[model samples]
Target chain A: MESPVDIQDLEIRLLLETMLHRYGYDFRNYTHASLKRRLLQCLAVCNITHISEAIPKIIHDRAFLDQLIYAMSVTVTECFRDPPFYRLLRERVIPLLATYPFINIWHAGCATGEEVYSMAILLQEEGLYNRVRIFATDINGKSLHQAKEGIYTIQNMEEYAQNYQESGGKASLPNYYHSKYDLARMHSSLKENIIFAAHNLATDNVFSETHLVMCRNVLIYFDQTLKNRALRLFDESLVHGGFLCLGTKESLSFSEISDRFTPVSQDLRIFQKKRGIR
Target chain B: MKSPHQRRAIVIGCSAGGLQALRTLLPELPPTYPLPILVVQHIPANSTGLHTTLLNHFCQLPILEANDKDPIRPGWVHFAPAGYHLLVEPNETIALSIDPKVNHSRPSIDLLFESAADVYQKGLIGVLLTGASQDGAQGLLKILHRGGITLVQDPKTAEAPLMPRFAIAIGAATKTLSLKEIGHTLKQLGADTRE
Candidate 1:
């Protein structure tokens, strides 16, 4: 008899294979250990007894699969998260972008649009919002829909306010949103230039000519191969001298494409795409 | 009961007073310790890696903030980074998760313990230490069910005993020892394994 661990490995492989063959979504490249946890979490949430049982439900039921997809995808995000990174962006990155007549930014794997709105707020304050367009994308359509809505719980505002102040915001964070009852809705002004779309980083084509790509907390979930693939896409997508910001926990030091970008703020994990010297 | 020499890995979980306890406990595991140690200590999502830095200062063994695809090796300690769940793969490599938090913590004790249990099975030794919440209870139970050795910090010695108390209530711990005793136990285990 196979050990429980081996059995789980088999089940997860089958589930990923089924997902790829049946739905055209390839999660096979995702880090295995995390994927197993997610599959098990999905199994528990769907009230399925086991992975083998969940696979058929996922294959046959579109609605259930959507729920499963949302659960599996990394969608947790907050406004001005890691305030220092935003501060670095405001201090160094934004000034360079201000020189451009038109700015194009991509917030890859933008979960629920917090970072999207946060970026808009920064550009607006910098007097550059009118000249910028942002493409905020995630693999999960449900998250895209939520990002488009721009609504979050009111309780999160206090934390966001603190983060905003720490990120060097000159105005109160409340100035960017309207709150009623238990929910806070971002002002429509912030949403004007943002195009929310469902784009899978794993399978999508390069988003060309982007000046900056902020994919914080997303790459840490991928295996080295998938991370390299994504980094290559970023390298291809970025304009020369463009910026890339990653989560504090992530690093380019181990990546095959590390040479394509040089450290702008090594501590903050911000990098500038090397201009022809690379 | 199996000798400490039989264990393949050591997994530990704590939350509320984890940092201080780690400072006291980590230094006790000699540089020549033979088993890999994986730790899950709850911290804010925006943690600045200070915990690992502080722990590294006191530890003789190399201490690292766990990152994706990192290999798990003996005589080194790995702490789960903030805002991510850390897991041990069957191949003895590290895996990090941005999956939703468990027990209100991203580097959840349960996820770490459970995954380590799956990977190491009976070869694992799990320790539940001081914590305000009961995050490690179910994971310790899973480790126990897998025939792994389970140790909980003696509630009397724990700064916040709810976590170990719960593990004890669930009949998860094979032995309950004070912080000093736990360190001594681990040191003896390390020496035994080397022999």
Candidate 2:
């Protein structure tokens, strides 16, 4: 006899399929362990009990469907999240990026934009911000909206300050933003070269080739197949010798595009696209 | 030979002085211990992973930090990394997630316990040790409900009593023993608890 949990897993698969077929929002390839937890959490938020019940709501309620996507994909990220990564990018990758008269940095799955702003601050310090255009995109429209607004809770700013310093900031992180009561609004200048848009890693294809692609902490949620698909997207979008930075735990080992890139800092999850696949 | 409990995997959770608690707790298993042991010990997000190094100094089995997508190897102890929750996928591969923290801790014990329970079911053995927070109790209950062996450190023997204390109060533990007994129990776990 199948146990309760196994049945629930079946229900989750059905719900994911319904969402995929109905609205074209694909949670179909999200890694099961994390997706199950988030789905359960979403169920709790909707005050629903079983995973099967979510299918009806998913099919009929358009607003609730967006809410589900927003809730499930709101990956908790911090500014300069992995300090060592930003530090590595600044010390190693930025020098290479500076060679291009105009550069594009794609923040795939940019979420709420903390990391995008972190990169903006880094480029501004490196004197590359003016020449750089950052394409910060996520599948969640709500997150893209927030990324454009660039306002975050002041309570979070302190921890971000520490991360900024640890990421080897040239100036105090607070200088990049102005605090208004409980919220900190990023300076208008930081947004000048940023374009926040909806780009689904599951379905979206690249248009412009990028110099540096920062999709850190995003691919861990995907199964191996979807992960490779996204990695291929990044690989195709990146120019020759461009950099690809993944989540600290993420690796290109055994990936379809594994041979196309060489580790710039394997421990920091930074890689350089080889000039040519030999 | 049929193992007594049919145990397939082991999971442990601890926090606050867990280093010392685990140091004394791990040396009980002999070198050829049969099942993979995954642990969740609450540490700083920036932890340098000193506990694995220290525990390996005395542990008969290898103690290493769990990495994403790694297969569960028998006789190895995989410690959850600092900033992410460690889960065993149904396929028995280690899957790490940056999802919201449960019980205000990223590497939450309950998250590991429940997921391990879901995967291992009655074949799982879960140990709840010293911890300041009440994270692992609900998970321990899930393990017990799934027919797995659940052991909690005797609160009097724990460095921080609240975690195990909470587990015991909820009738989660099948055995409440001192740290030494918890170790010895784990060492000989499958010898007796047959279905």
Give fnat, all candidates: 0.68, 0.56
lDDT of 1 by residue, A44-110 (tens): 8767877888888878998987887887885678899889999999999999989889998989999
Considering only chain B, what TM-score does candidate 1 achieve?
0.97
| Candidate 2 chain A lDDT trough over 10 residues, lowest sum | A30-39
Candidate 2 backbone collisions, by pair? none
Candidate 1 wrong stretches, greater than 4 Å: B1-6
Indicate the residue-level lDDT of A184 in model 1. Answer: 95
* Candidate 2 lDDT by residue in tens digits, A126-207: 9999999999999999989998999999999977999999989999989999999999999999999999989999987997
Candidate 1 residue-wise lDDT at A151: 94
Q: What are the Cα lDDT values of the candidates? A: 0.88, 0.89
Tell me the TM-score of each prediction against the true structure. Answer: 0.94, 0.96
Query: Root-mean-square deviation of each candidate, in angstroms?
Result: 2.0, 2.1
